[model samples]
Target: MLIERPEANAGTTGREREMKDIIIVGGGYVGLSVAVAVKKAAPHLEIELMEAAPEHVWQKDERASAIIAAAINMLKTLELWDDIKDDAQPINDMIVTDSKTGEPVKPVFLTFADRAATNEPFAYMIPNVSMVRALRQKADELGITIRHGAAVTAFENNGGHAKITLAGGEEIATRLVVACDGVRSRLRYMAGIKTVKFDYGQSGIVTTVAHERPHNGRAEEHFLPAGPFAILPLKGNRSSLVWTERTDDAKRLVESDDMVFEVELERRFGHHLGKLELAGGRRAFPLGLTLSRAFIAPRLALAGDAAHGIHPISGQGLNLGFKDVAALAETIVEADRMGLDIGAMDTLERYQSWRRFDTVRMGMTTDVLNRLFSNDIGPLRVARDFGLGVVDRMPGLKRYFIEEAAGRTMHDKPKLLAGEPL
Candidate 1:
């Protein structure tokens, strides 16, 4: 638990408790981004962020996330893109294939060229650690207080303010609390917000691999009988892999010896990339769809996985969280400028209204895509493959799909997402 206070404001008596305008729980991508964005928009607001893990642990996260075009715009608006741009690997193209495991040949069904009219790639693959590091540095520059190793044990919404108790007995009062604590968020439960959840009976095995040959900025998604296996390009000849399998099979593969794991990996990963070697450790995450019934209650609001969790089949989970960050920050900043209570139910509802429908739409789309592709039913496979082939043949349709994947669809885009300042 976080037991130290900020050095500049240390040594305060019991009567001089520090009160903040906003306190964000969880210091992951969503949480940190929200904190930084809000502080950027409204510098006068006192913001504090709490994380359950130690400060050093965030830098150790080896996972990679796909940042869609809209999220890239949001980062640029936050003035953070320049710091991490060199570490991002743009996805230039994508190929989709369908085949059963151990099949001698996998047939390509569809392909997408990611370059839009502006000659920009639709998305980029960035390391989670790098993104968090940049956001933390920006937050420090803005004087947003961050308490690592701090977990909110409980919270109470007493009409206008939220009283939060930390695990180490520190009590904080804030006008609003944003929960970005993830899919199984404790704060969401404490706020009495229920969720609609469905387990997919599958697990995603994630790791990085270095290949002898370059990927040439290409991404590949091979739809095997179990699930989709994605090879996303990273810096150099390395690529991030998201391999899906039956939960039991996934656990077994991850727990297997290096040689056994490599053998299984090579079976799905074609030799086109040449010699393959594991570039990082492996981890398996259970697949599921979780959506909160309400995004706001009293002085609390949900963001990121705390609000919605969708399948990673479309690689939109992190992008969706970034959408939440943009919307919530815009809402709070606008409310503050209008001299209204940012934490009020009316103010928070606007944010909910802005994001909830889009969240559900993406969640359902991924759910349907996972079900459609992660099976071996003969007739369904034939029909879906035919559909993919048809989409592949139409240039205009493919471009439209690429734009949608780039998050260029018609919707109530927040200012930050549109690369505008609040």
Candidate 2:
């Protein structure tokens, strides 16, 4: 059945009279993925995407994300991997160490050879701009309407359909509204979804560095007193850094002069990569764990950061969003194919159930890890290091950890995440 948009002041007597099938708020990776995934599977559904930022804003993002294998599979299914592959750097192995900031010798307590059995990288470091560019292109090809600078200010879930008012007083009605605005999503609040949030009192300073030597596709996580400092490999001799520190110290470092910043950075970064030069701009992001109390409310569904925002210590924040994309897209598409209301409470519950546990589990896991490792307690450090060493020696256990991190061992994954058409 073809659904048409109703004119202003149009009265809808039934759910079938909705103005649009779905209206997605926010045009980030998650929002675009939801639109592309649903439309490709169910072409009859009418979807419109709105971004509050100006056009081409995504192009200015210099950050990169660690995309796990399952998400890479989804991108392949969406026909986006081809455009994103060249810019992506694979992680063949990773090592973790718990040590002081200026330790002369940082013993690696745990090491993971991710590709020993699978013969494939567990994750890839993808530039944010590259990923968004490909998604926008795919959205365009799918004929999905994307509007920038269109901020939605008010939202109401009518019994028949949801009505949203933009900043300019323009109203649009749809059967479903998907919120991907961000961790601080206004849409989620508008839908009355509360979140369980915790501030870690830490911040991650992100920047790219050009090293004198190649990384050999190995990533490292050094657990310092302040927090985890992750060295994620990228294409060429450049690597991205997520240096965690106290909020006050993080702000100071970013604002510090280049000489002082690099001096402090080298103390934690080590000389393994030889001399390092700042290859990209630096910025600091406060670290926190935010889990939405509910994923759905009537005609509203929250995905990505809107639903759950976890600490970046594990690098699973964005991957979790991709998981939501897979699950929610599958739910909506499958419900529509069965001739059921896609925005119906029961239909949306399936998505919630599928994603809620995983989101909460990850949220708690990161919170615990950040609290445990981001300290200098002698006994605690010794106990955690002992645990890491034990896990490192057990080949089977290490393999399990690698597979889990790669997102290949999880059960009940959606078809899209398994590289199949939805």
Candidate 3:
């Protein structure tokens, strides 16, 4: 039962709400996924989600993300995959190449196909708006209370619970709080969690374009001197482009006239896709790597970007967040079943231990890759290209990499990622 403050109806002071079993901060994919996973596992728990943005803002997001096979299974377990499945575009094959921005001939050096044991594609490209819509619908159906425009201004962890203050001056008490806020998380700073961060001096240009020819469910990654330019397949004859460039050049291109922007895009996109037209607005994001020093402190836990933010070289940012969701949900549910205080540091430590190593590994891998490929050193380029070519010819090694990318190597994976109920 909700504990209502006696002065709740008065407009004089901020209203105070009863203690919640769990409070999740941020309304992004990680926050929503954790809420759904927890509710499905233990319906008795009172869960509340707080978002800074208004409800309609989520629908305005136009970017798309790569949902790896494991994350696809997690959504399916939550009964959300089917709702967005029709709009999801499977990536049947991938080709990697190394070339300059204006190179006329970009030869493929590495190729991978979807040949997993389940016979499903290794990943699917889904628009961010559609994924958020489906997750919101599911959360609502599960009786999860989501409060938009309710940003947490400050929070203090008492011995038993956390007292949280909202931006609007309201107060809330919860047994635990999970931070799923993006890279620059205010709550994380409030909790005194330090981060290891560095800017890459590059930015990624994200946009969608329609071409005269179809992509045929294929994805391509061109490692240019600046960074990796990815062409991920979308439905119909459209493809999502993630073009990278030095920060200064990226800013100029995004602010330039439409014709100039298109000309620059075409130089990197090549003419293989026939003619191209801008299908949506374009935006550029600064590239960086950020990893929190601690994933948990007292009654608080950090998930997603709040805990770790890595380079997008491999397109695994969102997938890593989903991995956090699975691990944290499982840790909490299991602890609750054992009659332990879910917010206790001991219980939270399990989650930290489970996810920290994997997160660090991915972060380092992406860092090395970004540094290795985002340059035009003649000797280094030749050596890396030769390595890629060698891997392409080794079918066994290729399959192993495909499985790893699909998240099928985790023997201790959470139930949700394994296509089972929480």
Model 1 agreement with the true structure over 1-422: per-residue lDDT tens digits = 11122333333336325767899999999999999999998999899999998889977778999999989999998999988899999999999999998776889899996597568999999999889989989999999988888988898887756778888777777789999999999999999999999999999999999999999999999999899999999999999999999999999999999999999999999889899999999999999999999999998999999999999999999999999999999999998888888888999999999999999999999999999999999999999999999999999999999988888883989998888999
Error of 2 at 125 (Å): 0.4
List the candidate 2 regions with Cα displacement exceeding 4 Å.
1-18
All candidates: TM-score: 0.96, 0.96, 0.96
Candidate 3 residue lDDT tens string, 1-422:
12222232232224667778899999999999999999988999899999999989988888899999999999999999988999999999999999998898999999996567789999999999989999999999999999999989998987777778998788887779999989999889999999999899999999999999989999999999999999999999999999989999999999999999999899889999899999999999999999998999998999999998888889999999999999999999988887788888999999999999899899999999999999999999999999999999999899998888889887589888999887
lDDT of each: 0.91, 0.92, 0.91
Task: Report the lDDT of model 3 for residue 327.
Answer: 94
Task: Estimate, for each residue in 118-148, the C-alpha lDDT of model 2 and write its tens digit.
Answer: 6889899999999999999999999999999
- Scanning candidate 1 in windows of ten residues, the lowest lDDT window is 1-10
Q: For candidate 3, what's the RMSD? A: 3.3
lDDT of 1: 0.91
Clashing pairs in 1: none
Give candidate 3 regions above 4 Å deviation: 1-15
In candidate 1, position 390 carries an lDDT of 98
Clashing pairs in 2: none
Error of 1 at 89 (Å): 0.5
